[model samples]
Target: MNNLASQEQIIATAILIVIYMAVVLWLVIRGARKTTNIGEYALGTIGFSPVAVGLALAASMTSAATFIINPGFIALYGFSGFLSFGIVMPIAIYFSLIVITKGFRKYGSSVKALTMAQWIGKMFNSQRYAIFFAFLSLLLITFIVLICVGITQVLSNALNADPFWVLLAVVVFVFGYMMFGGANSLVYTNAIQASIMLVVAIVLLSSGLEYFEGGVDGFIAKLASIDPALVKPTNPDSLLFRDYFEIIFCQLVIGVAIVCQPHIMTKSLLLKKDEDVNKYLVVSIIALTFFFLVVFVGLYVRVYFPDLKVGGQVLPMDSLVSAYVVSKFSVYVSLIVIIGLISAGLSTLEGLIQSISSTITADLLDPLLGKELKLDIDSNQILTNKIVIVLLAAISFGLSYQQLVSPNLSVGIFAQNGVYAYFSAAFVPVIFGTFLKKTSLKAVSIASVTAIVVHFSVYYGKFMPYMKEEVNNPAIAATMAILISVVVGGIIHQLEFSKANNKEALNVH
Candidate 1:
């Protein structure tokens, strides 16, 4: 796809990247100065404006998958991809985020919960449950790998450099700075990244306007001329968006549960005042509506590369957006898009590193070592958190390198399998714990285990008809898991409640 950039473009990109890195480092240093303990590191002591935190939430929620990887899917599958990723998913996610955030933050702040695992543990009065989730949070490293691969693809193509070296440099620089900044720097950096991404989203979305010259029908006609399936709302040739169930139902369910991730849901805790929640949600929903629509650029890129090849080489799915950027835009404009792409990845990357490392250090290690072994982890938690980030960086690099060299379909699939499972298990617990006045820990725990089992089993075993394909859809597996777990959890909760009520009646009589 003529992915290599011109020497002039490469030099300009490198220079701008250096300036960006310097600015980010300066902000990290500024934030690190105020971060004296784990509490400040996880949920900053500073009272940031709701607008900034809202921007951060939008950026963190819209990962590289939105900007770089998922568009590749849209390019391959066409309008059906847009219907699922751009439309249905965003609507469900916004609704779920609005429903869950305020209640979670109210309890989280009241309990001084530092991580999602800690929040769940405290809500159910079960440290063991929190520990289990802390370990499960390791699965988010797959998501980190997805972001790293995304940034690597953008940078490597722009610089005409080796992907391995680019990946290494990205992981080191990001993870190294993240060792200090935590939430304090994360909010500001993410806000800046979000602003850049918002501009790029507009540019990419508008880039396809010329295709709409003959009107919306003309655009559909153009796609239909290439491949009739491209214009269809449901593409039979595609694995992920083959029917109403996959395109709408599965995506809707996934979108609702997707916010259960630590990096996403815990973002509300960044706000100090209750009054700020509505403003924060309003800004986030508005910005994210634009960010998710950027996937439409895939259809534009597809129209540009009808054969899905350039220079007689078939373009890889993960590299579609990168190839399009370098080919479609002038050198200067390409550099700006490249910066925004990097921001899209870095915003979510920073949040994952901060949240997961905090989960490991605060939720997992502190409970085991400090309480059980009587170790002084409390005094050295900051140091311990840095160590955890280093470990996570190493793991992310190994897995990302594998995906870069040889992926099943795209790293998006690999990420979805892991991330979807984690959140599917979390969905019941987070929902029941937040809204229900009296929740049975046993019921939630059973539901969580059921979710994990069902997700992996269905994914690996190909239990459902939708999963019979070689590259199965993780969303389908996740949806089944979420539904089954909710049913199982609900029944158990009712049984427990009824038994307790009966006991109270007998005692009163």
Candidate 2:
């Protein structure tokens, strides 16, 4: 499609983007002042108020995946795709509150635990498992960076600007703020950016009403005229139905993985009190629910510009940000689009970088070099973390560029697939095990390994005859993975206990 942004809109958007970035940078730096040590920098020392933690958790997890890709998926699948918000949000909140209640309270305020791997290591008494989890966390972070880069390019297209330069600019700004302050910086900035994005969403949705020339019910009628199924609760005959359900179910299971997600876990850990968890859960669900509604505005674009094409390719289904902004409002909406996406990308990235750096230093490098290198724990840990942060960002930047420029692969799709795979394989075990007293460490091990094996099977076994043409959905795979983890984890734990009881009896005899 031809560029929708007028010069005036482009200019306004550029100014807004600059201002937004400045605000975010300020939040990052200001928060850093309170961060004298690793704990403060990594998890905010005291846990946040429940409201703040809730918003931060909801915002951090709602990346480009939810904003850009989901609406598009909805366009294809209608209500089925949107149902995930309802299913996953409550489950995630419930799981987090239960798992984190004790863990967060027991850990010292100044302990500076940055990653879930550290916490999990303590719980299971297994460094090997922790390292394995640490790597999976790193992989998820990589995909997150890629999504950031991709969204930058999309925002540029919406603004009629050079995609390469825009992506670079966003990367530099995000990296700088994250490097300076870490997770504290990420949360503070996310709160600010999230607020603005909400306002912008309201503006776009309000403006789109003019095009609808109808009230809410009228608009629904119009939408039905285009595709009746667009408003339905299900897609009955779609080949994708089973797959989509799998995605939603798995998403719910893996959503609990947010508890184990290093970046998000640290945010929860940083809060000031256990009471904050409940407040945060409520606030986060409300805010994210509103945000999801705003994104669905894209489906309305289909009603306005049904045949719009960009580069002879029908605007990709994932082009919700562009389609909604371009078709519903004036090009000035690009300002909101860019700011919202940047907000989403940077908040998550800041947390990811902070957590990853701490993991490498505390878990890997420091243990090896601490005594021999004669480095002091506190000062050297900070220095090592900073260095690792820079290196991780540098590597992620390269991978991001490759995905952006790749011939056929879209960064958004690649990330969604990879994240679901990683979460299913790694986190499903930890979250469930936390609540189930019957769950043994060995059972957790079985679940984790099984998930990894199944995940890899879907990817590599694509060439196998039975698997070929199976059209693997990461969501489906993740759901199956978690189920296996839960069932196997429970069974294994029980069997082990049974064996121990038998041994005790035999010894008495």
Best by TM-score: 1
lDDT of 1 by residue, 1-509 (tens): 25468889889999999999999999999999999888889999799999999999999999899999999999999999999999999999999999999899999989989899999999999999999999999999999999999999999989988999999999999999999999999999999999999999998998889999999999989988999998899998998999999999999999999999999988998898999999999999999999999999999998999988989998889999999998788998898899999999999999999999999998888888866633355448888899899999999999999999999989999999999999999999999999987899999999999999999999999988788888999999999999999999999999999999999999999
Show model 1 residue runs off by greater than 4 Å. Answer: 1-3, 371-379
Residue 225 in candidate 2, Cα distance off native in Å: 4.8
Q: Please estimate how well model 2 matches the true structure, expressed as its whole-model Cα lDDT.
A: 0.62
TM-score for candidate 2: 0.86
| lDDT, candidate 2, 1-509, per-residue tens | 34666777777877887777677767767777776656556666444556666667666766665566555666565555556544554466456545654554355233444567776666676777767776666667656555665476566666676666666676666666666676666666667656765676576556556645677677778767777776666665332333445435556665665455566556666566666666766776677766656546555565665553654556655554555564456555566666776666655666666777777766666555668644465666667677777677677777776666661224555565566666665564556445555446687777888877776666556633223433444545555666776677668878987988899999999
